[model samples]
Target chain A: MSSLIRVRPTKIELIRLKRRRELARKVYRILRERLTILVNEFMTRIRRAYHIRKEINRDILDVYNEAAYLLGLYGGSIYEYYDSTAVENSKVVIGFENIMGVKSYTAMMKKGKFINTYPELNEFRERSIMLISRIIELGRIEQSIKTLGVEINKTKRRVNALEYIFIPRLTSTIKYLQMKFEEREREEKARLKRVKSMLEKHRG
Target chain B: MGVRDAYFEDLVTRVLTRELRIVNRHLPYKRVSLCDLEKMDIPYIVLRDGTAHLIDPRELEYLTNLLGKDKCKLLLPIIIEARQSLGEGTYIVRDRVAKRVIAEILGVEYEEEKPLIIYRPHLYKIREVLPTTTTIIFSPT
Candidate 1:
């Protein structure tokens, strides 16, 4: 049986349960503070991500259109050549940067070379790279925000468990044991009085 | 924290600082000053917020070859307005190829005779493609 329903506690047990409750309270306080800060940081990250996405959507269309128009004017043959070479073996440099103590990836695309035949094509190719890099940066920020959001929720769950479930049950058990101990003490006192009186009456 | 604790903390968190200092190439963007831009020809001028494309004197002359000299403004650092001159979040581009490129991307109207007025979306495209070539200026609210 659980301690809440059927437990008889001696003074030692009561003291132990009281200590456990105190520790739970202390942990809850700390987690609650962390949760508040996490939520605020998450909000700021989401807002920045939202703006960046909007910027990307708004600008990306025109750039694509321009690329299409420019490519069409030149020839379709160039697209495949440029596409194969523009991003060959390119690695994105990813690292964590802490914003208000939460870490997020800061990404930068490292390109190989600008080895295209046509000068006009180079212009379009370079533009494509820039647009893609912006997308990468925005994606990293967004993913970090999501990670923080999940952590925040987990923290909240722990806080709730401590407050509503574990702490309350422990407290009730402690109260129940204290009441039982007082009742036992009173009973012992009455029995001692009765025994002493019987001895007095016999002596009379 | 104790001195020893602070020293260990430094060891754990030191990589983050190094990454920030070294690899922030395209994160916030590196800005270029106007004084430095005028001494020699450059493709772009960077403002605090966004990069702006520069109109070098030679490039302006090339623009003059196409649009004729009277339209060419013989000055560096042209101001691209958003609200008053163009629409909201726009920069008026003068080059024919660049204008056509922007127009094609944004699906916005353009005129061969007049300077093309670009909105936020189009400006975003230009900034993405030619980040160094263009700068962003917000309309006063």
Candidate 2:
């Protein structure tokens, strides 16, 4: 059975390895910084989505309870209260103000056809549900976006680890081996030259 | 036919041919008995079915042209056809085509059943007697 012997590395190989390692470290540092920024932004968006969703849900419940109470008092649908000219004239100022606020908020959220989409609920009730649904949708979008962000961050970390640790370590080991091999070759060449001169002198 | 009419007819023909290709390519995979599908990888399924099996959200126009104006009606049959081809095994599909196919296989009644936004990482636990009622359970493990 033959034994396996290790060869030493050459200087040229060591230089090449060191250059590669330095480049890899620089790339790793840049990617890590980018990943940190992306993760931070993603977390902020997730928090905003959560807060907005909670606010929308609370507002929906409030609107539903209030509408139910008003319906009970009026003895009919809320539309009847709004449609009657006399009632509308009496509460026009305050009622218009409330309606205007709802309309603007819904519009700001880009929700249209609030009443028709949810005809089962009264106008105010429908508006509240629509707003809540929009908020929920926004939350869902944020969650998906956050997940992608997380995946990107993980990938970046993996790349950085490979660049900084695995590649550099492997390169250094290769360089050391090459230098040892080259030194052995040079020494052997010098020994062969010396032996040739000694044999020439002996002949002389 | 006038030039415009001929152009329209050609367009229709090309679309019909593409749709036929999509259906035909998927046919072999669909025709595979449900019992034989669990052994193959996802890329194999895609290759066997054809590239059309992957639906990009951006490529809605192509899908629309292939399916026709009555998208709501045609959506289910196309999905069922594709799923039937994929055979009987669990699959993780994030693409729109896969979502549509799953919805059809399960017989989800709603036309606007949204694409699954979240999936349980462990898909093997899903069991359903009816194809349409399967609930994907997500286990972190």
Candidate 3:
């Protein structure tokens, strides 16, 4: 365990400790502000992510049903020799930006490699591509939310430590040091007065 | 104080300073008046949240005209809000001061006492309008 700061009965140490306490309070305020912003960002992202899932859900069933319909009409053999009408590939660019001082992913997508194929095959492939993009977007949301959550927690913990523990302890320590210094000064003044009286008595 | 306490206090101060620097490092390049956004060379601000939002001078002029310039003490920005009470994909504008400007943009009714709840597409619209000033923030529900 880390030991407590030792008591120093000096005016200088008291001033220094007071300065430290002021810094701690300021840090606490900044951290608390950051925490509020981080949480808001996290919540916003989380909500957006949830809605993305809903969007996917709404689009997916139709696409899947269309796919099944196309397969039934075109026959399973159609799958054997069909041109690629769907998106051949999708390139997802994941960007890292500092949000609330936490580096997290921001997604940008480039549509890639589409070809013309049979009508049914085209429909099926398109649905697949759409689903894939939505899925990728969903993945991006989740990753960002995760990073943000970690950041929010860290900020909160630091705010709590400074506000509840560090500031209070520093305040008390500074107070104690000031009190001790005052007491020592009073004692010295009293001793000096007594010595002066004794010297005067001796001279008389 | 003793050597250990000095060291400990120094450590705390150092850590706090580091955090402060990290947070401040990403602050907007500089806050500019809505009027000057377009005439200025760099018509953009990097939000503290780290989004590079571009401001359009035309829209700023349009808004200033709509809000009657003088009443908009602090120009206007679409503040997208995310609160626990709000549903997913929902953004709200609770600042009544900006509601008039947003109402002009969206053609929605503005209520002095109420907030304007908006959806994703509307969020896009606001972003389109005031990219730099409009920011998303989570509020306590």
Q: Give the best candidate by TM-score.
A: 3
Itemize residue pairs with steric clashes in candidate 1.
Answer: A62-B105, B44-B132, B51-B134, B51-B135, B52-B133, B52-B134, B52-B135, B53-B133, B53-B134
Poorest 10 consecutive residues by lDDT, candidate 3 chain A? A79-88
Docking class of 3: incorrect
Q: Name the lDDT value of residue A71 in candidate 1.
A: 68
Candidates sorted by TM-score, descending order?
Answer: 3, 1, 2
Off by over 4 Å in 2: A1-34, A74-76, A79-110, A113-130, A149-153, A160-165, A196-200, B1-141
Cα-based lDDT at residue A85, candidate 3: 38
Query: What is candidate 1's lDDT per residue for B1-141, written digit by digit as tens?
Result: 357744643442353233223221222234333334445433343333242323333433333454343343222233334333242234566755556545654677889889887655554444333322333332222
Error of 3 at B81 (Å): 17
Quote the lDDT for A38 in model 3. 65
Give the poorly placed runs of model 1, Cα more than 4 Å off: A1-5, A77-89, A93-108, A111-126, B1-141
- CA lDDT, candidate 2, residue A3: 22
Compared with the true structure, model 3 gives a TM-score of 0.62
Model 1 has a DockQ score of: 0.02
- Measured against the true structure, the TM-scores of the candidates, in listed sequence, are 0.49, 0.37, 0.62
Scored by lDDT, model 3 comes in at: 0.66
Off by over 4 Å in 3: A1-4, A75-89, A112-130, A196-204, B27-141
Order candidates by DockQ, high to low. 3, 1, 2
**DockQ of the candidate models in sequence:** 0.02, 0.01, 0.16
